[model samples]
Target: MIPGMGAVATTFVAGVEAVRKGFATPIGSLTQMGTVRLGRRTESRAPKVNEFVPLAGLNDLVFTGWDIFEDDMYAAASNAGVLERALLDQVKPFLSSIQPRKAVFDHNYVKRLDGPNVKKGKNKMDLVEQVRQDIRDFKKSSGASRLVMIWCGSTETFIEQGPAHQSVKAFEKALTQNDESIAPSMIYAYASLSEGVPFGNGAPNLTVDVPAMHELSRRNEAPICGKDFKTGQTLIKTILAPGFKARLLGLSGWYSTNILGNRDGEVLDDPGSFKTKEESKLGVLEHILQPRLYPELYGNIFHKVRINYYPPRG
Candidate 1:
């Protein structure tokens, strides 16, 4: 299951269906296309990763997600325009069969976006309970023994780990009191972890990066990961920065700018949401370059990231 069935989520669902139907190849999917070397190099024992490790096949996957917008997966995929119409049409029936559930959303957290399809609750804890119920219903209906939740959601307003995030007890109390510190992403994470479902965060929100979440994950034996999906600019930086550092290259400044018109672009147009993304992007270089280790080469460097929302590009 997923939260925020937007461009990323729809593309994923449609792409998987397309691949399963043999319309296209899973080119960038490591699990589908990658190989792992075993034993000695001379053994020539390289096998596909999926063969080496147990994993679900494309046909075994099922799709469901929550969206503040009321569009079904087909409509959402078309609106995204990430995939060609011809490809989407081939998978239209399959995509159309999937519809998003009402999402847990708040205008305060995602300032630039709002939609009619949203969950209503008396407090944050009530929202959590509602989400938990959604999980149970999906599990029963889908007949899937194990489940995972990937947060393909929008970037929320910048927030820090606070007193409410220090422990599960504190978080529960804060949720009951409708604390402003608890963002929508956190609510989903809390619900998923509580249900013992693995949760993967695909946006730069302080979702599972807290002590309370850590404790919950351990107690429930549910896996949780991420603050961002390094698919674009950050992916490039992670690749190139390490090479630059290995070669002992020096950098004085690095500036990155992007102009996008998708829903993500519009959402990031809000400064609060942009700040969260900025923090995730800016940390990449400092981490790979090891500024503390190579003070002379990296310490004084300036880094700037700017994102401009251009609807015309869409």
Candidate 2:
């Protein structure tokens, strides 16, 4: 479930539906109909991931989510304004069917948004209860026994580690106390863990990666992984950086820039959010370069990422 099913989510869902309907191919994602090499040139064999593994069937999988706006997925996709008209028209019915539940939102998390479809409560815990109700209702309504929530939502403010996020017990107490450290994404994470559902943070919110959420996941016998699901440009970086390390490429400078008109680009327009993404970008070097190990080669490498949220040219 994409909590905020905008462009990426709609594209993913529409692409999947189109593939299911024999109208298009799953072009980008590796999970759907992706092939893997077997052994060697001698073997000359490769197999689709689905064929190789006992993966859950796509027909059996269900998608449901939350959004701050009341717009259905089709409308959200249209608003995101990413995909072409022909493609959206082709998948309108499928997109329309996947209406989002009212969002578990915090305006403090995303300052630019103000929508009518938001859920409200006296405190963060009440917000959690509403989201839990949403999960329960979605499961019941959709008749889906298995559920996974991926937070494809907007980035919240920068939250530093604090006592409120130290442990599950402490975090729960903070939720009741309305601690400022309890950001919106953290509230959603708490809800998912409480419901015995696995959660993934698609945005760079560090939602499930927090010590509190990680502890909650372990305690609940659920799995959680995030910081982000790298998309677009970052995917390229992951590949090239690894190859650079493998080939011993002396990297003097690496500058990454992107210009696009989309919700993603718009969200990152904020300095705080740009900082969120910029940090995620910086993390690549810290992990890939191993500053402790390669202080000589990577210490001086000037890497900068710039993304301008330009409106669509058309």
Candidate 3:
């Protein structure tokens, strides 16, 4: 299940449905279109990833998720305007039937956005329990063998690991006491890991990056990964930066700026929220360039990232 049924999540669901109905192809999805090469290069044993691996087909896959807004998937996708009306209309029956459950959200974490469709609890622990119940109910109703949670939620305010996030015991105490460091995203991660559900973080929130969450993942044998999905400019940076580093090219400065008018852009307008995204985006160059190894060429290089919110431009 997805945590945030916003533009990205709804667009993905609608795209999958369109592909299932033969209206369109899964052009950009690696799982659907990518091929895996088996054995030596001379061997012509390559096959499509779906055919090579024991993966579920598009027709068998199910979608359900939570969102801060009360809109169903169809309405959400329409409001997002990411996909054309004609395309979304073709999958209206399927998309309209998938309604989002109330999400666990907090204004402190994402200051620029708020909605009434949110979970209310006495404490963070209570919120986690409610999410756990939602997972159980969805599983029983869907009759799926296994489940995975992908955090397609908004970026939360920048937060550092505190004493509360050091261990599972400390985390539980903090959750019960409603600690400020525990964001709503963390609550969902904790709940999913506790129930043995593998979780993925699409946004750059410190949702599954802390020691307590890692410990829980290990204990439960639930695989977990991600702080960012790394697309757009960052993807290019990952592809090109290594070339410059390998050639030992000197780099003095790098400036990256963006103008996103989506819901993500609105949420990132707040400085606290921007800091979270900045941390994730800024780390790429440092790690890729490895200034320690190439001090003369990469050390002391300047890097900047600015994300401007342009509502009409998304």
Worst 10 residues of 3 by lDDT: 305-314
Instruction: Note the residue pairs that clash in candidate 1.
Output: none
TM-score of each: 0.98, 0.93, 0.98
Superposed on all Cα atoms, the candidates' RMSDs to the truth, in angstroms, are 0.9, 1.8, 1.1
Candidate 2 lDDT, tens digit per residue, 250-305? 67888898785767777778787778788888788668866577766677788889
Clashes by residue pair, model 3 = none
lDDT of 3 at 177: 99
lDDT of 3: 0.92
Q: Per-residue CA lDDT of candidate 1, range 2-116, in tens? A: 9988889999998899999999999899999999999999999999999989898777888789999999999988888889999999999999998989999999999999999
Clashes of 2: 0
Global lDDT for candidate 1? 0.93
Off by over 4 Å in 2: 36-45
State in Å the error of residue 162, model 3: 0.4
Angstrom error of the Cα, residue 166, model 1: value is: 0.4
Candidate 3's error at 264, in angstroms? Answer: 0.2
Q: lDDT of each structure?
A: 0.93, 0.80, 0.92
